[model samples]
Target: MYTIKYRVPESARSGQSARSEEKWYHVSILTQYTCTSTGASNKKRLHRKQYCIATTKSSQLENLRSEFGLPVVMDPIGNGNCQFAAVSYHLRQYGIHRSEETLRQEVVTFLRQTPVLGNRICGANWWTSILKQPRNNLSRMSTEYEYGDQITLQAMSQLNNMQILIVSTRNSATTLISPDGSSCLSSRYPLIILGHYPEGAGEHYVALGYKRHALERIVDKSAQVTWETDPPTSDDDLNVGGDDLSAGGDNLSAGGDDLNAGGDNLSAGGDDLSAGDDDLSAGGDDLNAGGDDLSAGGDDLNAGGDDLSAGGDDLNAGGDYLSAGGDDLSAGGDDLNAGGDDLSAGGDELSAGGDDLNAGGDDLSAGGDDLNAGGDDLSAGGDDLSAGGDDLNAGNYDLSAGGDDLNADGDDLNACDLGSPNTSDITRLREMVQFKRNRKHVHQNRHVILPREIWCIIVDIVLKLSPLSRYSLQRVNRMFRDLVGKTPPPRLYLCPSRFGDVTVSPISVRKIIALSGSGSGLVQAIRQLIRHSSWVNAWLFLRLATLCGWYTVEGIWYRRKRRN
Candidate 1:
């Protein structure tokens, strides 16, 4: 129902003729009311074209060509002949015998005779205008499709019982859609459409670069192909695809994929086999494999939980109190036992021995603390090995690898000398006194260091630095934010003078502490420094003191008044 027109500027039309811009006038859509066989209730959308008086130049349609990425040709079939030309172009490609002029005349005939077109039917001139046409030419012209519209195309399609896909182009922003409905129509099956121009000016249409049917994919439905996932699941027969073996019941066999629920004692020899909690046996290379007396062997084997005993090359006895035997093994749950060359028992009260063995939990006793009695690399993380609450004692050359209290009593074979000097019977008593005197210094400073030694050291260094230096260090990271926060400000002098006598004032200490950001403790240190000290120049201190905010005008006034 909406009408869109495009007209170019007069500047671009300087040397252009009427048909010059026709290359840009692509497709115009018009609607006509029609009735169906069941009744007038059924309505259908139709495509139509009108003889647009204005023309559009090719330069104005460059955007359309760039977007669609195809060559464009203006309509050469004159006014009112677009539908016939468009339909004839498609029919000839499909080897249909049809002329463009003949189709145009037929489209005109279909529109004039259509009952729904009513009094304003297309190609039917007024009674007064019809008198000017010659007698024979009047009949052909009335049905000659002076201008083709949507209803004209519909009637032709209904008569031939063929459906056609048409594309209408309006502007540069518009995207060309494919016959399949979502994509651009293949260039092989080219269609005509309107191009870019100013509104209500000139209308233009262009032919696309290719044909539509030539780009369609031809599919053959008669060929037969086999799929691997559809393998048969006969009893004891392996499934080809290895997925969803058998849903009927248990004891159903499948190869390649994992197994779901099945019968008791069902044996699965697949690559990655799995079974329900109920009793089941798997002899697969990997994955879970178990039975009542399950024997599993592979790189990684997991005998599912329960009172099931597993004996294989590699067995992981994950069940409670379950016994497992393999070269490399791991066992979980309480009271679970395992016997292997290299064993790891996780439960409490586990007794295991091997070259590399680990026994966790309380009361885990081994013959010599480690599997290899005198071998290196022995680690026991559990508490209370051997005698309950005693240090876990390993034999000579073997260490209690876990916590220091490997044995509950904190006693171990690796005893450290607690600075107790061992003196021979022949040694003199005087020499021992000398050694004790030297060791006294160590005990005296033992309480000097805080528990957090590293943090205290970094804080002391940061606090001793100058104010500017401390400021730079404080911004290094968030961790040191408070380290330099209480640091004292820089002082005018670094060392005291030796020639002149130095004196300390309570008021100066208070003033310096307030300005230096140092606490009252700094005053005590300053007092101790200047108590017996001497400065090289006494006047230097007085002059620097005033500049350093040590002396104020009020203090000077009070001193002069006291002197007066």
Candidate 2:
């Protein structure tokens, strides 16, 4: 078993930031709760397969009792990696510790050379296989089940120079096997065990880093034995180091007259010197090299004959010089011009007239966007007009006038210009045409001429019915009879002797008559049939009835007329 420093925030006074305080705890693969002396009711526990978990709660140092609270087990919330955590905890117990990142790097380094481990790293299968053998030979290996104690022992043995061995079954023990073929019993120390229990199968591994004696002795108090390793003595073994120079100290030297005491001027000899005004002439010049003129512009004497004028302007010598004393013109360089209130002539010329002749060069121009010639002596008579330029003037022309006659329309229109029309006019125009058109009148009363085949079908249906139905269709109106006049109605003779024969009666008429009544019932039944049939069928039935009635009347009339 091993111990690691778990840091918790020390609760601060009101309105203060929390400070962190370190607490040493016996950490391993085994499930345990975190105990505090403040109250066991609020102390939370960690379950199996979890070595390090952070809590937001700021736990004070007072909550930990070295005897009972430090190694309290908490509820487990993680899945798998129990064996890895336990082995890691065991290493930490022996003063050799690796962080999670370092552990991952070591595993990757070990797996890279082993071709039989395939491309994957740190999965369940690879861990299981490595735990079982812990040797370089990875041929025909199986990484199926959870790693047992033997596999973990083998893996730990192969990991470092330290020898590790596991005791399984009835007397499960841990032994620190050494390199010199010597073994020491480590059962007193908490051992990481992998086993199945009554609660579940496929059991996970658990680690208890501290020894049994240490665990018992430090029961109620926080564990505080230093778990850090000392630094190695050899400088060659270190990756970084400091030089011989110490920090926070200056190392400088000054020699001879180069070192000034404390004044602005360097005065090494113990002579009184005036070091004010950033000048050393009083101390260095005993012969009065600057003389009494030093108090009044003495440096101007050695300034290449530069004058100290009252205006403080430098005298112009040559090369585009502007005379600062007066406005004296020079004539050598490109900008050799005199400076004054107004420059009449240099590279360009200028002239001004008194009355209204604002002339600069040779021409008195009658030109501008708004020209004004009160005397009307404008000479430029006919020139094409450019924008904003003066108009051409002829004899007795009022070209210099600035009034309504010169008001050229400034309302220039572009391609997308919209005219300023009145809002009321636009509204009235929209109201004159704004409405939905009446489409229902045209749709409701439209003429639709049907096809010839439909009319022929109506007549054909009228021809296939019995005489009684034909007479009933004729009673509908004259128009229906004219429509069915193309086809004659079917003759349906009712004879009780030939009732079952096909020629005696039509099936439709026979069924209607049979289903109805015989004798006087036939009349009302036939009338019902006329009402029930379609227009075409009733027309055909009426025609058939007319034929049958005519035959009977003709036979009776012929016999009576012959007897008379």
Give the alpha-carbon lDDT of every model.
0.35, 0.32
Query: How would you encode candidate 2's per-residue C-alpha lDDT over 1-564 as one tens digit per residue?
Result: 788777767888799888998877777422253433434543433331133322211231112212122232221112334445455555554434543224434544544443333212432444454434534423222231223333334334434323333222112222333222234322211223222121253343443322334433332122222111332234322111111111112221121122222322122121122222243322222212212223223222112233432244444343444344465434343232323233222323222111121122223222332222222222111211111233222222223321112111122211112222212232222222121112332443497765434554565565454433444565676655644443343323344343333323223444534544444454353454354544212211122233222111000001122564
Residue 273 error, candidate 2, Å: 72
Per-residue lDDT of candidate 1, residues 422-513 (tens digit)? 22221232233234434554566788744332553567574554223454566787645544433333433322332122233213443445
TM-score of 2: 0.18
Task: Identify the leading candidate in terms of TM-score.
Answer: 1
Worst lDDT window (10 residues) for model 1? 217-226
Best model number under lDDT: 1
